[model samples]
Target: MSRTAIVAGQGALPGLVAEALDAPLVYALDGFAPAIPAQTFRLERLVPLLDAMADSDVSRVVFAGAVRRPRLEPEMFDPRTATLVPRFLGAMQSGDDGALRELISIFEEWGFEVAGVDAIRPDLVPGPGVLTGEPSAADRADAARAAEILAVTGPLDIGQGCVVAQGLCLALETLPGTEAMLDFAALHQGLRPDARGAKGVLYKAPKPAQDRRIDLPAIGPDTVAQAARAELAGIAWAAGGVLLLDRKATLAAAEDAGLFLWALE
Candidate 1:
């Protein structure tokens, strides 16, 4: 019947990707229908699922969602996974794009064409603008500084978002993510009382040469809400690479929150 498959990751992007490709999703979690009919399986059972798809005459596979970097833990390892562990680790030691390219090569060897979410859902890409409205000059200046700081941090594969206020880096997202970083900054009295209404700037960009298939930088309505709660002034993302999920809703939310969103060229 000429079947196709989608390996799920995280967020709404996976669902959108599956819909666009007209493929059945391979649900990685148990008993979750995932807004689409999918064959459920566990992560440890990936090899078997791949085998099943191959046996079913699946010709292509699309990867979507936010797959967090897997933590090294003994309990999560399986015999089949163990066989590929060394190679995976070697790729990690190399570079993010290198790792993704090598993994894509492996998939090609299995007789499946691998594509990214954007291949199916290009509309999700944000356009150049202050998606909400024009940022104040101060906010724009802060965003520029935040972008500079983020440029250095991104190559390390640390995190994408950063917060800047009055040219000072108020927070840099580590493992805790953007929301947590903002909460921490607020708690630490990072902003002065006089700077209460001052707008903080958030800068998000994909790591230099990031693997688009796996780690596409994403922002949506939740990001807008978080920035609003933190008294942030503006949000900036890489123009071509960043993914803006729920574009209209996200813009509406940002405008409602009095926050500015811009796609950097």
Candidate 2:
């Protein structure tokens, strides 16, 4: 039988990818696949896994989900990882994209074909439009301003999304994420709560030159609910790069909550 390995990661993406690829799931840690049999392996065991695959009848391998950035403390470095430590550190110091490309190169060297989620779920990619109801003029103005600021700040790895109101930034998402940023904006006094309507505008986009293989910005129903709770006006995402998890359902929920969802080209 031709076997394929699904390398698991932290989020729903890994599970979804494994299903889509019809592969035997391999967990990075203690993950268990109830419906499909899977094996658990440590990150350092990757070299050996690749070696074993070479002897097997495996035809392909696919990576999915989010791998937590590996912690590089001394104690955590096994022999397999230690040899690559210097190169890995150098790449990280360079940039996120470089590091991801290097890792993908390592996998390819091991004879595994590295592929992106787009290969399996292209429909989930966002397209240009106001996905829900039309954004009011005020919402559009705020969204545009937020997108402009995001374009400037994102390349520096500051954050991927921002909340804006009446052409002023209400809150820019830091490490806390979009939901937390909106919550913070709702509590701040300077933002006009009643003028732009409930829910302020949220603009999300890729950092300029961001690696498409990893850390692509994502939005879903949870983001919409957070905006609703914060009374924000709308949500905007970059058209081609952002992942709209459960696109139709997310838009339906946003519409139900009277929130505008737009995808900017």
Candidate 3:
């Protein structure tokens, strides 16, 4: 019998993924972990962990939720991981996307197939449409502008999301993440005389050339509240290109905040 392993991280996403599969073996990262009980492993000694998974007849692996890259030191590395340090270091230097691709390649070398969360739970990718509240004309315009901005930045390995208010670029996501960008937009929105307190939309999309089988853009209930804090009109993401975590709660949050959730084309 074949078994699948869920290499989980923090948040509801891990639980949701576990629920989608049958008796999935759970492996939690040392720092970032799933809410459910799991066998914890560290990044430095990954080869042994892969060996363990192989022994258990695990043929597939799925990653979910937020995992920060671990800082590596020479002393901490096991023999196998140590040998791969040169390749891993080069991947990190390229960008987040590069790091994921390298990890995927390593797993393939171990004879395991890497699967995407959506493969198990297709419901998480909402169809193209408005889910909760309706978007205004301005919101649609801002959403379009945000998509265009992300397309330009995605190829540069910059970020997957941005905030546009009143057709003005308020903030762009970088290594600091989407929440930080939202907070910055909240602060800067009213500073401009022309855009004083002008409402906008938070936009999210997968970076072009990103490997969807690993890390795709995602949003949840917390996102709605964050956009509301920014005093924005709504949130939008590329339709079928992002994960809508905890669908019911996310929609409820959007409705309560009067923020439209747009799954844009």
Query: How many clashes in each structure?
Result: 2, 7, 0
lDDT of each: 0.72, 0.71, 0.89
- Write the residue-wise lDDT of candidate 3 on 1-265 in tens digits: 9999999888888899999889999998898877987899987888999999999999999998788788876798998888888888899888789898999999999999999999988999998999889988878988999999999999888888999887888899998888899999888877544655448889999998999988888999998899999889899999999999989999999998888999987
lDDT of 1 by residue, 54-139 (tens): 88888877766655445466576678866777777787676455566666766677788776677778888776676667888877
- TM-scores for all candidates? 0.83, 0.81, 0.97
- Per-residue lDDT tens digits of candidate 2, residues 1-265? 7666666655555565565665463645444332334566654555666676666756566655544455556666567867877777776775455677777777788777766666666776867987778888887778878888988887777678888877778898876567779788778735574663534688898788775655677788888898887777778888988888767778888989888889988
Candidate with the greatest lDDT versus the true structure: 3
* Comparison by TM-score, 1 against 3, better one: 3
lDDT of 2: 0.71
For model 1, the stretches where C-alpha displacement exceeds 4 angstroms are 1-3, 29-37, 69-79, 88-105, 192-197
Our tally of clashes for model 1 stands at: 2
lDDT of prediction 3: 0.89
Alpha carbon lDDT at 104, candidate 1: 76
Q: Rank order by TM-score, top first?
A: 3, 1, 2
